[model samples]
Target: MEEYKKRIVKTIQFIDNNLDTELSLEKVAEIAAYSPFHFHRIFRMITDETVQNYITRKRIEKSAFYLALRKNLTVKDIYHQFGFSNHSAFNKTFKKYYGKSPSEFRKLAPENFHKIQNKESKNGQIDTVFDQYICNIENLLNWRNMNLKIKVTELQEMNLAAVMSLGIANVEPSYNILIDWAKTKRLFPKENVKMLSVYHDSFKVTPPDKVRIHACMLLDEPLKKQEGEVFPETIEAGKFIIGSGEVTLHDFEQCWVSLFLWMKENNYAVRKVFPFEIYHTNFKEHPEGKMLVDFCIPIH
Candidate 1:
């Protein structure tokens, strides 16, 4: 694909990974590796609708899915969950696209789900043009309901020096960069170094510019950096909730989401330490395109 097309694809994937977060144009542009003004023009020319319109449409569609499948969650909860500011705002836009109020649609959702899924506008227009979410509603809900094995353990503090990155990392370009740097420096030895990452922000909570993701190696000793900053930080000693399973790179976001949900249900409070991951093996060397990873989040 051409550069702009590649960037647009990445932007769409970013939206998928962060549907619960605020997706401003500037934030989405960062994922595409483009300036905000330039990316907006290119996106509009290529996608027709502006970026804001696209995000709003996708959110509303996902909201519809939530309304149908998540019976326990209230409409108000689903409204805010999809990032709408309030009921009035969600209702007005929802009616424009779905041609019914939120409650009206919810009441009819069970018997008329097929109709809702195939719903269209009066002028034969697409209620929302989408390449993914509309087509995969069942799979999305099923994945959310997955059961994963977890463990709670207490561990001592760890010291790490990482090459931190700021961007939408669903594809983990930052991990690639850090591994390349390690290869040049002969870091992360089989016995001497551990490959780990200290995630300083939640993809669902932190702003794109302020996210702190450190693609790091366990250091035997603190060493001076040759060029970029190497941060020395502590992974505090505490109890932790660990979600472990054989998973591919694609499963990282959902895995974390599930773990946090598990924590809430189990009544474990999140301790204010940046969560980190421990890889049983490197991704490049894994034969199945999957690896054993212990996703460790500190807890009280």
Candidate 2:
């Protein structure tokens, strides 16, 4: 089962990286090293979604991210970038999922509205929305003001043993699983082991309860065999913008938001790779109960 899951995860990663291209079921099945018929059933059984559904949903979610954050890109540009054939199909599918046209969704995004307000306020408009979103943005900016250091660096490919968690609340449990697995493998004395949490979905685009996170430990060498729910994965070598700081649980979301804001301010385009955090010290053991981490965002 672990081996099967490892192949499925590889297929998912491939699909995520190649979202802009055509992703046929047979092609993805081959990635999992399974016959198309059997792969389809197994994928659905494990992921609780059909392969095509997963592909479409991911495309739509990514498109939605572009719509909300990359306001400069027109709806046509986004749809085409995500491999949609035409405006009609894209709009229809997007509306079905979001209950709004792409334009409407973008217009309704609080972050976009906040930016617009900032521009207008400079011209004496001064309108404001006293909502939770405003508070969140302010908190993010406050955290950014803490002199968070960001640097661009290249990383070599990393081998990881990971356990997948479905939501933020389950992340700790996932880490526990990895920790125990590491102990059994005698990979403890974790002072040298790199612990990371890979974000598979953007919290801004996906619901908090539905987000996917992978709790991973850097492996010195690839595992000889899979163990239960833990599986082997790799983070390909790439250039990344890393934000390093000590952050509390309450400031975690703000840290990510601030990093993206920094990326935008610096005119950096995001790569298809998932962003992740590398922990230097566990919050549970910190004097101030803060996690010392480096949030790494891949860039083009």
Candidate 3:
């Protein structure tokens, strides 16, 4: 798993460095040391788009940046800058995705253009083009309807030994302790352990490190008999309105945002300290289809 993660990071670096070139699946496969046939399948499975499709989407995304920031550059100039052979092909692809010509986009969709450019700019901390492309594609494919919601009523209280984090990035090591210690303590006894990660801060404002994630479990009674370091204080009991959605891995933020908006519209006041995720689908298991995360938001 660690090796695969390292390879994925290297692939991202390679793409960022060579976006101007023709990014071929065969070449990327070689970089990842996979056969061409298998690489295409894996790429789509991991990225939720064909290699060619991902490349084209990234090109268009970069074109959006040039359109907004380098206002003096002509449409043809921006097209060729992205290594498009001709302006017409560039216009065709852009229109296909955004529903407008380059000129129309510049004129009528200035805000969208600026938003893209600003997001891609330095200090913005926007993710790679591939991530953005995957997210947009997922949103187009899966939009939620409130009526489709499934309710889970009567969730009991939980006691957790936790270390809180805020605006923090890349704290996988810290959370490992929670998992490791819980096991050593035999917290779940005969019950199958359930892993829960709760996010307490909005990603938009909080730096990645500051995002609080409480890695915890639901315990059985025999385990609860043990006290002190063996058990932490009980997690407060509350009535929670649960809403869940399965989304492409890239579209996690959209799912979270949609759920938050739903709560807001329905007048549900969520406590900041208790946000949680029940991971129903592992990322490695289904790299393409959808990742299921069930959220429990306490309602007043």
The TM-score of predicted model 1 comes to: 0.49
Instruction: Please give the CA lDDT of all the candidate structures.
Output: 0.68, 0.79, 0.56
lDDT by residue (118-207, candidate 2, tens digit) is 112354532322235445666767768784788999999988998887668889998998899889988976666789999888765555
- Write candidate 1's Cα lDDT for 191-295 as tens digits: 635778777545432334434567777666655532333445457688999888788888876677667666766877666477888877767778878877888
**In candidate 2, which residue pairs clash?**
none
List candidate 3 stretches off by more than 4 Å. Answer: 1-142, 146-152, 166-168, 187-191, 221-234, 271-273, 285-291
Model 2 lDDT-worst window of ten: 112-121
Model 2 TM-score (2 dp)? 0.77
Which prediction has the highest lDDT against the true structure? Answer: 2
Task: Compute each candidate's TM-score over C-alphas.
Answer: 0.49, 0.77, 0.45
**lDDT at residue 93 of model 3 (Cα atoms):** 83
